[model samples]
Target: MREIYNELKRHSGKLTEFAQVLVDRGLYTNTKHCVAMMRHSTQFRQDVQDIYAEWKPGKLKTKDTATHNAKLAEVFRSIKKKELKEKVETMCEILEETLMTVTLAIKHSDVRKLGEVKANIENILYGEKQ
Candidate 1:
């Protein structure tokens, strides 16, 4: 749980701490609602188990990414292949750009931009040019 919260923090600052607090409160509120619903509705109680199933894989993914990224960073620090380093650096930039763009698209409900991102990812993965 501490690691999970630290992962949520992602960076150090008072604002980040405040953000965590806000997230905690939001979760608390939603959990209370869920409990109330569960008491009142059989469907809500049964349906909530699926949410846990979905979240379990995501939690594992979060931990796995942290481990994977640390190893990648370590490898990059010792790696002697300039070409591989340059390619990895370029890929990192592409990933950062995609992360930001996809986040903004989802936040704004921009379906068209999301579709474009899908095509971009496909092109990158399959060696197809737009």
Candidate 2:
């Protein structure tokens, strides 16, 4: 049970880090940005789901232990909820940043610059920094 809690805590921390990364590099306004964000979101969700599934079994098996199970359930629920909220907030921040980048690029008469920036940002976000 302690091990399970530790795993949940680790995953939650990773998800929080991923969200922060998304928020930090919210400057893509082209195909790269869209693709990178999509991939990141997909992977993050998969990771969260996997962690939840792992906890679910333990939670079920220990249902007879109401106090222990209830504590586990509460931790699971709280962490998952906070992870989701952070995900949404970070996603929105990314979108807003992308839109702002596009607007600025178009206004400055630099469409090509926008594309370059977008691709670079995507590379950074997706860890394809080559």
Candidate 3:
């Protein structure tokens, strides 16, 4: 802000005094220019992305975990179309841990062996619906 003020002082034929609105407009214009420059900077973009990642790490992880597990849940549906209608218990916890393991395994598997990994997991944990 002071930099903008000094520059404005020197720019208009080295004026010693300026109107209040001119100073205000100079500050506003400088702010907008700085914002535009930041918007165009790759480092600024990365900094913003880092801030968002820092802001909600847990929420983002939970959402990602849900999405990843949904893929595993589709495998579950291969054996049964039924949804748990009861107040499920520790078994649900076990099932979730097991599913999460498989989900992570599938995520880390080699691209070439993806189909094999998925097929093997489904064969072991579930079978055809009919």
Candidate 4:
């Protein structure tokens, strides 16, 4: 019973930590930022779980079993690589929009108009970008 309780506590603690990550990252006014953060946190937790599973002893092992470990490691690496690639793509879109807005404001907006335009763009991008 004590072992079961300990295991429950361990899992609950991990979930609590992941929830905290969501709360902290939720501060971003942008939805994409929130989405990216949550996805990253989830991926990190999954990676940890995969490593833990791999490290635990199996009921049996043969020469083939060693190859299984290597394959699992490759799979984990691939998952992380894919996630990183997605994040880069999202970041590029955000930066491109910001740059385009700034350029348009410079070209067409006057001093007073620029302030209003900037504020509007901020509200649109970062939900009142402080």
Winning model by lDDT: 2
Cα-based TM-score, every candidate: 0.35, 0.39, 0.18, 0.38
C-alpha RMSD of each candidate structure in angstroms = 25.6, 28.3, 21.1, 23.5
**Can you tell me which runs of candidate 1 are displaced by over 4 Å?**
1-80, 128-130
The whole-model C-alpha lDDT of candidate 4 against the native structure comes to 0.53
What digit string (tens of lDDT, one per residue) describes model 3 on residues 80-99?
54444332444465456656
Q: How many clashing pairs in candidate 3?
A: 0
lDDT of 4 by residue, 1-130 (tens): 2222233235535433433444455444554554344444423455434433453344123358778899999999999999989967776776677667677767875455556656655655675444
Q: Give one digit per residue, the lDDT tens place, for model 2 in 9-61.
A: 45435333433433454533454453345444433445434544653553332
List the candidate numbers ranked by TM-score, top first: 2, 4, 1, 3
TM-score of model number 3: 0.18
Q: Which candidate has the highest TM-score of all?
A: 2
